[model samples]
Target: MLLLFIPIGIMVHLAEQLGKMQDNEAPFNEIMVYLGNFSITIGNILLPIFLFLSVIFFTSKLASNTEIVAILSSGISYNRFLRPYLIGATFVAVFMFFMGMFIVPNASIGFNEFQFKYLKKGRQDRVTENIFNQLNERDFIYVSRFDPVRQIGYNFTMEHFDENNVMEYKLSAANIRWVPSDTLYRLTSYVKRSIKGEKEIVETKRRLDTIFPFQINDLTPVSYIAETKNLFELNTFIEDQKRKGASNINSYILVKYKRWSLPITAFILTLIAVAVSAQKRRGGMGVNLAFGILVAFIYIFFDRVFGTLAEQSGFSPLLAVIVPNLLFGFLAFYLLKQAKR
Candidate 1:
């Protein structure tokens, strides 16, 4: 199923992205990397649905053959008959926990970077205008505009305050560009003003190559930055961004919550699938498969809606991850009761 499904997904994506890739003359080797990352990201996202549908398919077949009836008739309680399925679900949940936490984030880096570099050339994936960040309690920075691809910001200002919230010095620059080769920041038209005793001491320079407390990415990270960090890195990154008072912090927290929620989702969908398909019916596997697909789409819909709300609005990210799983958990319980009867 993976061989067939993954190839089809790649074909569809390649069709849509081929024009942009060709126009940008994307290298064949780098394109291969993107396709590999695509496989990892897409497959991981679809893992729970695949598990649900596969279980329903096989279980429905067994039900049609009276295999499930034999097990129940042979003095095994319904709950005991469910033990193996539960064990299998436990294994899958653990596997998915590790995959979502450790493996997929690296693929996201390759995938998203290639997307912005080739298909979305000249379009910034990060915030690019009127950026502001509080580096620490006493230091703040601002920029009138930024160009992510060029790694430069215009009309940059850095201000420092004393313990009493009094202005100590202010630094302004016409432009700030990261000099990657030199490992330093180049500030053009640099000027500094020191305030003391109601007098201002001014200093100016044509250009200055120096270091600041913050990195370029600290200004406003790429929209998908959180998706590119592993579990450990993501937690640390979130805390750092929070300290900096990043305005889009919710989006990062949403990623963290979703990763943590995948295991619970696996268990919920597994139970629901077993409950729905373990009993023989007139329509057989076809009916079970169709219903499975419908439920899968509904799950996807709820997840997307809540995720968008959390990322765009002020809705809680934790609730966004939890609410859908809770709804499905209730459905599983109802279906399990009906199936037992």
Candidate 2:
């Protein structure tokens, strides 16, 4: 298994570096940094799958060598042999679940930043013409133009509405820029107006810098805004987007659910592998490996199909994310029963 994975790892690493080089963006040192970070990210993502495949390969080899027969003859049930495997698989599943839910999200942010800088040529973070985002239940922000290159926003406006759905306060500025020294934003040519009941008040300032409690990363373009938020962040963002009446949150919702579902796939696919390869057949491991690959491919295909449908159609994100797992889980159980007989 190590022999098999070593070449695969080398290939993946080389491909990642080569792809970055082709982009002509980052220097070799920066590219190496990005490659290292990405390798760790992908490794975390694929570890459970690799472990599942390893179990199947080793278990099938043992069976092919008649070791399984020896154990069976010694009065040990097949189910008993599965105890250790189950324990190991459970550990892997739990580890993967937590990593996917927490660690991967944070790593993804750095990985994506690296990609944006070195491979995407900074295109990923670009914010162009007028952008509007509903920041909260009663507040919305608008920017006429934002230049990511300059890290500045122009013609910015923030409107705060009261519970009665009436605009209570409005702030407009000619420009806003992050003042890293103070860890706040500085707004220039700013005008602040307030209307309460029948009274109106206005305030103007040449330059105003305030500590905006929220990070810029926390606002606007809620979805596809940042790749570095954990499940908790993603859920919060999804709810915020939904509350803001955003229409393109389906994909994010699908991803949020799919993160939980993907780890369960290890158990489902492992069961399928055991069922397909448990009985000693005239055909060798090649046949079993081929069958495993085929099943894995089919599962992946349907997963993509459902995911795309969820985004394009009216399908529920939860169902779309989990249906493949459910279908294959049932199939695995059926095959396991057949193999037992």
Candidate 3:
């Protein structure tokens, strides 16, 4: 089922993106690489839904063949029957834990970077205009326009303040560019002003090479940066962003919480699949499969609704993740009880 669905998904995606690929003149090999990464990312996202349906299909078949009834009639308890399924779920949950924490983040980076670089025409990947940043307690930076690819900023200013909150010195440049090899910054049309005892001292230079405390990317924030980092990187990034008081800290927190919740999702989905299809109904496997699809869609919808609320408003990110699992946990418990009886 996974194999059949993957190709169909790729074909549908390729059809939708073909025009954009051609219009951008994207190379054949790079496009193929993007699609390969896309497959991994999409598969991880859809793994639970497919697993649920597959379980329902096979379990329903066992019921229809009387295999389950025969085993139960032989005095095997329902709890004993569920041992292997639960063990399988444990293995899958472990796999999901590693896949989400370590592997999928790389695929996410490649997928989103390729998307912003070539696919999103006339769209900016990072903020490039009227950007203001506080580098530290006493330092502030501004840029009129920034080019992330070139690592350059235009009309840049950095202001430094003294302990009393009075301006100590102000620096401005027509343009600033980072030199990767030399590990220095080049500033054009540079000017500096220093205030000492009400006397302003001015300095001017046509060009200057110096080091600054902040990175060039600091001028323009990447909107999808949180999705690109692996476990350790994301942890460090969240801590640093918190220190910097980032306005979108909630979004980063949401990503972190969601990654940690994937294992829990695997368990809940597996139990729900087993309980829902372990019985022979009038409609056979068709009814079980149809119900699986409905439940899978609802689970995804519930998750995304709370995720949006957490990221957009003041809702707790932890609560957003837990609520869906908690509700589904109740459903799984009720279904299992009915199946046992």
User: What TM-score does model 3 achieve against the real structure?
Assistant: 0.90
Question: Can you list the residue pairs that collide in candidate 3?
Answer: none
RMSD of 3: 2.4
Show where candidate 3 strays beyond 4 Å.
136-138, 161-167, 195-206
| Model 1 lDDT at residue 284 | 90
lDDT-superior candidate, 1 or 3: 1
Instruction: Give residue 219's error in model 3 in angstroms.
Output: 3.0
List the lowest-lDDT window of 10 residues for candidate 3: 240-249
Residue 128 in candidate 1, Cα distance off native in Å: 0.5
**What's the TM-score of every candidate structure?**
0.96, 0.81, 0.90
A best-first ranking of the candidates according to their TM-score comes to: 1, 3, 2
> Tell me, what's the RMSD of every candidate?
1.4, 3.5, 2.4
Residue range 52-114, candidate 1, lDDT tens digits: 998999899899999999999999998998898889988988998888898999899999999
lDDT by residue for model 3 over 166-210, one digit each (tens)?
Answer: 999999999999999999999999999999988999999999999
- In model 2, the Cα lDDT at residue 260 comes to 80
Largest TM-score belongs to which candidate? 1
